[model samples]
Target: MNWKIIFCFTLLSMLETSSSSKIYNVDPSGYVLYCPCMGRFGNQADHFLGSLAFAKALDRTLALPPWVEYRYGEPKSVQVPFTTYFKIEPLESFHKVMPMEDFMEQIAPTVWPPGNRTVFCYMPRGNPDSESCNAKEGNPFGPFWDTFDVDFNRSVFYGPLNYDVIHHNMGDAWRDKYSSEDYPVLAFTGAPASFPVQEENRRLHRYLEWSDDIDQRAEEFIRNALPKGAFIGIHLRNGPDWERACEHIDSTPSLFAAAQCLGYRNEYGRATQEMCLPSRETILQQTRKAIKDYSAKSIFVASDSDHMIDELKKEFKRMNVSVHRMPNPVPQVDLAILGRSNYFIANCISSFSAFAKRERDIKGIPSGFWAFPQKPQNIQNSSSRSDEL
Candidate 1:
């Protein structure tokens, strides 16, 4: 055989061995990339007429795996890629990674010419034979694909994926695997349009769309922060951060304002503060005990009530407990964090308080009274008297 042919045979033989790590949990994944430029001029023209219909990006695409998957491929999870994204990119947003299968068809039903799908990328605009500078720097609009390592024309590690893991990719390290018959239907590299990503759309994209891409990441964080045996996420909506939550709780007249709930009284001759919005004193007492319970790690406060939080902390001088608050001021997605908790502690009156309970009911997570009126009947009677006055 020719020397070149003989050398090729030897390379294949060596590749089959050394790099085989025991593959256990195989995470399936695929791409869903898009950007403001590059998916659809259909050609590199200075005067292309038509709305830059990027949604048409998927017209040439196909379906995805039941669940998308991604390996860390490397350490270090991605931080907010853009600044001011704290608001633009919610904290809990990227922390979750899910299977691609979760979002099958997200296109709203009523849009005209009703054929669309998720993971839609931009259409190709440059010359098929060569990268067109016109496509790179088009007129009033912009380039068709301008969001990658263009500084160095070399291929990018994650931009419009060049290879699938299950499949072959010139024997590259980041190679992906895809079915023999499967291949990428579409790919693009750029920032998507400036249209406001609808609320529901953004939610679907973050938690549902990019989920599989970061599944390993989300799971690891969830596990490290909260081990999976059992947990009860008690949401306290609208409270200030911990320092503020504690300070607000300190101001309440009742030592256990939030604690004087209506459920069965404990050994201290007091009622449990399960779901009712009580005084800050109640929150203080319960917070301290939460530290000692060994039953629970931390309590989730979900309210926007700034004053109530610090007031509640005042009365809890005896117990050592820590409060974990989402760094965000206004949370867009209702906290599903509560349902993940072992049992729940909700405020009696507020709908926000019940968000956790509702999620628990849906997911079949068991929950119990975490707060209530200290004396339901008496409290009602007192309220009635006050009304008469």
Candidate 2:
């Protein structure tokens, strides 16, 4: 027997053993993947939170996609990264986060079998005539693929996906099914509305918390712009689009009683303004009440329309309360400031406002939806509004 040949055989056997052990040690949870699909920061944030909750329920890894560029006519180049806008470390212990490119190029193919990728559409559980879903189909946001310039369908699981309708009754089933799947990769599309509202909010508080930069900027703005006292944060969601939405709720004031707006569908076939958008009078009244009740010396206003901000400034000034608005406000900055407020007045239908409220809830700060008729004394007992569309 050749001694050199014997030594080579032994080395080969050891290498094979090591590889087998490593393959067995790979964690299934690490293979779980999620790609966020939606428009704007608020909608994307909702999708992120919903995906995060689903990931938590099933113990899957969430691949944070680049922010959707819904504002531009089409999905342009993604300049911002996920960690830039949100804190990823808080969720690292329980779930994993990865770049969309890595998930698409490296992880997805290995985990999911060919032609078996799953797409979970996050629409309202039971409502067939959901406007948000319709809008998503009509006006698709984000680039087709995770990595720029790649063929969307080929790069990842993109096609007529096998739709798993996620509604109130379907969460547990989906979780169990996904958890038991043999494949390593699981892909989801649409905005996040799979879990129950309360569960989603709890998870949102945990994962969607802002990054330190956002936190620092918000604090600096508050320190410099706001007076030295408790402040109220108000989300005045009024604009041409919202104004039209308000008409959906104009005839149905009863629907405004709840924190989450729900009622008959509008022309767009989704929740009407009656369910989400409050009247201007209602906004003004609520702001005044919030200021007085919370004993706030200043008010921070986040609005889509500059006209609305100016009006709030004059109105708040008349009431002898200082008004603060971000100069050329961005969504993340506005949200950060709103979260730090002593008391938060959220727009009933706006996901943007809902995001802030969730942050405040995590911090044990009080918040209320402007459209909620029955104002609660404390935030913990706040109205049960469905923030997701």
Candidate 3:
């Protein structure tokens, strides 16, 4: 027997087995992991819809990012897990779910390719002065998503070696180009606000169900605060920051209003005070009309200003109306209660209000913006007419 021949054949067989093992262990159905970059709860909701739609379109598993921790006095940060606020499905259903740390330490070395990777830079960039750059040219929803390259060490490349960037406004044509089997792992990042609002709402309803705790809290708040009948929900955004932002909307009505609050302006322009801040009288009138039109017995007011709520209470009292607010003052609780209302009135330029509106729309509840009529220069005296609710 030739021992040298046998030894060589055995070594060759071992190499073949090792190669086959590596090939078999690699995941064929890559995942679509995304990190939602900005915005609070509502903005994150919009991003969630975009990521979910992108994942579905490519037939990839969706990995959720941590929520943005917004402090009152401090800078905003993203350190909290998304599941901390909402109840997402278990990670077992997806291709993979892990913290950014786990992805870097364990998954990256295994999945990421040995060289540069593709990054779908979803952030839009162009000269502000040019109309052609500003217009939606390639994608209908604007230049929301673009592809670029970055080293594998970058945080955005949290998945496989080879990936495809699924930008916000890439359209159906781009999404149709790829499938789950095409890559070992795919990742997405950025706030995906360019997806269709209706489709976004539909996916949101399907994927991101509120946590049980949130649901219970909402139910309890509604039971304790609202009267036992069809009620009206109102989101009055009058925070100090909102006051300034409202002016932007008022001054640039052609740009902001026409763009549905999605467009940007380089300059801070001036507008009528009425356009920026709705007068207290305007709030009262709008609330009164909502209560009358809906035949609602109770009104749930969600606002950042407690003083405004107190003032509203006195006015509602004068009109023989019942007004209620959440005792805890949590945004999620307020949103849940508002969503359950029979009707809702919202500030047009508010994402928080928009969030509630989307939730209500999902339930087929009627809702409209609280259109404040411009104040007349001569009308300085307060009217004494009080309509009974």
Candidate 4:
């Protein structure tokens, strides 16, 4: 009987373990997680990771970044995770990330009562999209808020953890077009506030067991594929069919015409639709201006735009200009490719592109953004590409 119990315990531990080679000692500080989101546009971890960064940024006077570690019930509404991959008791939920709509907006501490490091709460798969990404069939967040009320949140909110920008460069004399609300100012010092980042970036080394050799191969892909010098990177990943994307390519005018079908709208004109993604020509033109403005810089490109890249290669060859492949190990096969470079030029609506270049990959505050003239800061902004860094 003892042998049976011992064997069962051993088997369960093996199954529950996060890995095979090395066991991860869960951090006592606990993990801040943003799970996959609604538009499901951002990565799975931003909500958590961004909170981590923002929390560190707050001074005594600053309100906490808009967040709640994963939790259960509230004044109303079922527990927050009835739809997400919220492992109750053993885990937590999150809050709906607040948008910075005004430059003068301020982040205040939780009116939601405080807890330290305890998982916050928020349901992900329901009403709007419903059971899409991490939802476990129907028990989204576990049937109801009443579940896990005893086990979870009982720990207490860490209030806010260490959150701040390790390094940040908002703007210089040349460019200062940011709005107040977009990134807004913090509580006390009133310096520009740090916003949310995905939990993925910081937890990456822990979640992913990518090998050093995998990283090496990804590096080779970039070295052999990219062009020389400081070039502008154009990342066009938002599309219906990845394979047929190249065929639809023409001048930027045509892409602008397709509009939403292209998976992006000119964000600045978010409510309207004036600044749709600049046509290919418009983007190239802007890129040229950006490059010229910041000389001694070369584009080291990397994106999922195979079709667009192939076309650029042909165009470069025809014009006798140099270009690089930039494409490397596919995201599905190798996650390490993300570790190669910290900078990017993202497409409007492609969360993959957004998730890739976001603070998760680079580990910083919302340093610089790139979007259209009327782009909404919640989703889009137009700062210099890598140059903004």
The root-mean-square deviation over C-alpha atoms between each candidate and the true structure, in angstroms, is: 18.8, 9.1, 12.3, 15.7
Question: Which candidate do you rate higher for TM-score, 2 or 3?
Answer: 2
Question: 278-363, model 3: which lDDT tens digit per residue?
Answer: 67877778878887787788788888764366777777776566888876588887888888888887664555676776667667
Candidate 1 lDDT at 338 equals 55
What digit string (tens of lDDT, one per residue) describes model 4 on residues 115-212? Answer: 31122322232343542222222322232212322122322112232233444432221013212232232121111222223223344223223334
Ranking by TM-score: 2, 3, 4, 1
Candidate 2 per-residue lDDT over residues 250-366, each given as its tens digit: 343322223333222221123335336666787888888888898889888888874376667788886678887988787899989888888988875676776787677778888
Write down the TM-score for model 1.
0.30
Which lDDT tens digits does candidate 1 get at residues 1-389?
99999867645544453222221121222233332232111111100111111222222111121111112462322212221111212322433121111112221111111233222222333553442222333421232122221121222223353222223342232223322124232223333322121112222232222223233333443466553443334544333332333333323212122222221122222322233334555555554555445455444455554534454444432333334445453232224455455566665333334334444555676554444423523321111000000
For every model in order, what is the number of clashing pairs? 81, 7, 3, 65
Better of 1 and 3 by TM-score: 3
Between prediction 1 and prediction 2, which has the larger TM-score? 2
lDDT-best of 1 and 4: 4
Residue pairs with clashing backbones, model 3: 111-161, 112-161, 113-161
Better of 3 and 4 by TM-score: 3
**Order of candidate numbers by lDDT, starting with the best:** 2, 3, 4, 1
- Misplaced by over 4 Å in model 2 are 1-26, 72-79, 101-182, 191-204, 250-275, 374-389
Could you tell me every candidate's TM-score relative to the true structure?
0.30, 0.68, 0.64, 0.40
